[model samples]
Target chain A: MARVVFTANLHRHIDCPLQTAPGRSVRAVLEHVFAAQPRLRSYILDDQDRVRKHVAIYVNGERITDRERLSDWIDDDDELFVFQALSGG
Target chain B: MSDRLLVGTKKGLFELRRNHADWSIAASHFLGDPISMLLADPRDGTLYAAEALGHFGVKLQRSRDDGKSWQEIPAPAFPKSDTDGLSVSYLFCLETAGADRPGWLWCGTIPGALFLSKDHGESWTLNQALWDLPERKDWMGGGFDDAGVASICVDPRNSTQVTIGVSTGGVWRSGDDGASWHAASEGMHAEYYPPPRNHAPEVQDIHRLVQCPAAPDSLWVQHHNGVFRSTDGARSWQEVTTIRPAKFGFAAAVHPHDPDTAWFVPGVKDECRLPVDARLAVARTRDGARSFEVLTKGLPQQHAYDLVYRHALSVDATGTRLAMGSTTGHLWITEDGGDAWSLEAGHMPPISCVRFG
Candidate 1:
């Protein structure tokens, strides 16, 4: 099982509370979480099922590289953090 | 039904209730969200708000209890495009099919796409017939990169017959419930485009469109070139060349019960999208487009630089009340048709649209 947490800013619009789901990869973990909060998937991923340009996902202090596939492996004790990248002046 | 106004703005959604002789803000929902469009279904009193988040993309929220509470639903999005760099910039229009077709809704989005939802706002599917049209390849955006569907008119007499106005793609009609479409910009002109190209079928830029309920076949359009009216369900358009103040504006409000009666807020032109001499007024036409009367009582007569968007001007079903919101965050309403007006709200976020229900 892996723990997933959404940023406070994202939580303002959606209730993406701490979620624990069983999965071996980031994509599977996200799929499990999205099943519970379906609306959150749109805010994180675009129509092409790819991570949004401004959205960032990290697994245990390391950022995921596969934005399209989201195939990064994770362990049962891993923690995933999803937050929007801050930009603009 | 109680009189209420749903105002979508750059920051949030504001609800205004008619209080006897005056209007008051009842409540504000979706605080700090850019509401691109809003629709209040008279069939079920359901309220739909389209929010365009800068960081997260588009979102749709629905309220069944007259906007007291809202539930986020699936937002309309384009199918994964492997060739075209397509993305929904924002939802530009939200419309119901008709009284005969309950729970049926139509949504127009940027990048030029149409979506239909048979279950109200719960789900939506892209209308591929309009998407796969050959003219879509030539449809370019007016201000942005890609064109957008800004207005939709569903024929009350026949739900299957519908018309849509694209920003730079001209008007299209679907007689088989969006299964197929054909360009309906026969007599519309595009003075902004170069010669020959200006006469092209799919090159006319439309700012807004209004259909007369009294005559379903009659439709009025505020084109980028001029004001036009179609007597045969948008099959052909005739320019209303008599409209004062250059006939260049985005908003058009038609009378609910009279096909000949309509209103417009004319600006200078494309280069100067403001009232002539900075004087604000609402032009009303009682005899179709034969003539127009400029109404300025209680409106700014000098130094008023306001630009009304396409959906910002609306007339209620009763054909008596008219409301408009400007890009400068000023709202005005006319309870007695267009004879007089009063400022209802000011200093708020830039208004995206105003709907009276």
Candidate 2:
């Protein structure tokens, strides 16, 4: 299982506990996690389900490029990171 | 007079209580979060606060038992079919339907959309009529990069007769409780545009629109270039050309009972938002703009760079008490109708809106 880590700042507002989720794609992993932890979707995505402009995601220590589709490829043992964009917070 | 005040600021929500002549900061909530708008719903004493979290998104919470406890409510958002790629950028205004209609609320937002909730803000839906208006295509932002619905006035005589002010979009009125709408700023003009386009009712930049509660037909507007008054229930407007200390301002408040009486914080418009001659002043009209008075009783007269936002100047229901907050984080309360004033807080986050309950 791959682990997903959220910024400490986000924890200040809502709790997104550290956990491992299943998936080989960023979107699928997020969907798997969002199903268990609700209201977290709104903070990471917008009305159109696109990654929020101020939120950045990473897979295996590399920043995801497809923010809208969140189609970044991932490996089974890779880690996912969610963070507020540098210029945002 | 109001004994309680709710001041939403750039970083938190500050609650002040008044005991006789003294005011104290009783509590603070959502600290370190930008509070964009607030409504201490006079109809039910239910308080709603709009938190604008840029990194995440806009969030909403309501407190029924004062500030003791609050429940997070869903913030208004654009539907997936937003062809223009529109999303709620900010929650600009929140207003009740009327005293007769309980649990009904109206919310205005940036990118210029109006929302409504019939269940005490438990949920909200975009007002389709105003959102889909063809004239909205002409609307653009003022100082903000995107236009917004900044003011909403539900007629006291009839809640169905709703009037709203868009930052770069002109005044709109709905005769059927948000089911339908039309441009109501007929005589209102915009100096930002040229010749014929300046007269277009759709692009007038109304800084704020306020209705006198006792005289529902009388409306006052603080515009981008000057001030305007409407006596025919917002169907038509007439410019007030006599205001001094520079006619440009963002905030306007009217006396609850006297339609002829109103207050404004005048300053230089556009990029230069400083007080004229660096002297903070409140311009008041007691005779329907026939004449004006610049009141600076306790406000800074030297090196005063305070600029009051549209929702920052609030007049309580009694018409005698007024609370004014500025971009410089200065909050002042006037007990004698602008004849005198006193600073309550000199250091705090820049205030976005101030409301009395």
Candidate 3:
């Protein structure tokens, strides 16, 4: 079981989800996140399930650009952050 | 049944609310022909409307205590002193700073006019810096006279730092309580339209402006050409999402408290098609404008042409009420944002515009 933190710009409080999984990687963690929050799946992934453009996912302070292998190996105490990339003026 | 829909149409202003399990016209008048935009105040529950036609010109009408009573608060026309000021043809948009200030209304008009009202729906003062700014001389015309002042965004936390988008002219910012102004269109597109330069550069016409309250520097702008995102206020923008086949439409609304969540309706560009294949749908970006998904649950099936104008989209206090009115005299509401929409009211004149209370 791994502890995951979920945060968005709109809310004042943070949400944390706990998932128990055997596979270890960013992809596995995301699959778990999406399975738990279906509405969040579309927001985080494109039609092909690739991380959509303008989205940035980070694990333990380091940004992860690869969406296909989002399930990259993770240790027990790693922190993950998923957020939208802003661009309009 | 308590919630009502107010619509501005080519004929006049009309209000539709439920009475005895049936939707009925609460009020309809041709006070100012071709009523363009409608804004309902949540503070006092008054409906404020903008006229797009006739010599009556950009008048602000309000209804106190719901739609039971109505009064017109002679909003100001362009002062004669500024010979270069835009002529009052239409009022495109009106926004309340917040629920904190009872009567403060900011109105956007045709010919690129911005008016501020400190006294509820009563008198209005013009933001001169916007018209007198050094950038106006460079603005030619985008051909669509109604395109002016389509974007009016008030900072959630700070009302003083207001932003307005002027088509072809670029986005303008009023930081010091509208006393002075500066061009915030640095990263915005400005498609120059002239006999020789007809098609302005891409990303020029910004139809919508929204800010992340948590990240005020982050703004989202929907253009006639494309969508852009800026993390540093209006300093710079980068193209994030461009879904071909549908590029035009007005009004992009951000969740009242959640800056990361926003939505916009898209229609075919230039060719003048209804919003997104003539379907009643909304495209939402839960993570800001970085990406978007078409929200079609509970929408019409036959693909009706329901064009929702610039002033028609709004998100309520809890961000639970996502209400939008269409030019086709239809009003839709979703308690769960744009994921699914239910027809709150329907069947009236071609609705010129709609707003929320």
Interface RMSD, in order shown: 1.5, 1.1, 21.4
TM-score of chain B of each: 0.98, 0.98, 0.83
- Candidate 1, residue B127: lDDT: 98
Candidate 1 - CAPRI tier?
Answer: medium
Candidate 3's displacement at residue A86, Å, is 50
Per-model TM values vs. the true structure:
0.93, 0.97, 0.68
Model 1 clashing residue pairs (backbone): none
- What proportion of the real contacts between chains A and B does each prediction keep? 0.53, 0.64, 0.00
- Write one digit per residue (lDDT tens) for candidate 3, span B240-341: 554333656676777666767877887766567486556667888777565678888988856678777766777765676677777777777777888788
Sorted on TM-score, highest at the top, how do the candidates line up?
2, 1, 3
Mind giving the per-residue lDDT tens digits that candidate 2 earns over B1-357? 789999999989999999777998999999999999999888888999999897998888899998899888888888886454666778999999898999999999988999999999878898999988999989998778888999999888888989999999999999999898988989988887898889898889989999999998999999998999999999889999989988999999999999999999999877799899999999999999999999999999999999999999999998999999999999999998999999999997899999998
Candidate 1 interface RMSD (Å) = 1.5
DockQ of each: 0.55, 0.74, 0.01
Index of the highest-DockQ prediction: 2
> Which parts of model 1 have CA positions greater than 4 angstroms off?
A1-3, A20-25, A58-65, A71-79, A87-89, B81-85
How good is model 3 by TM-score?
0.68
Model 2 segments more than 4 A misplaced: B82-84
Model 3 alpha-carbon drift over 4 Å, by segment: A1-89, B16-33, B43-46, B53-55, B81-86, B97-102, B140-143, B190-203, B212-215, B242-245, B275-280, B301-303
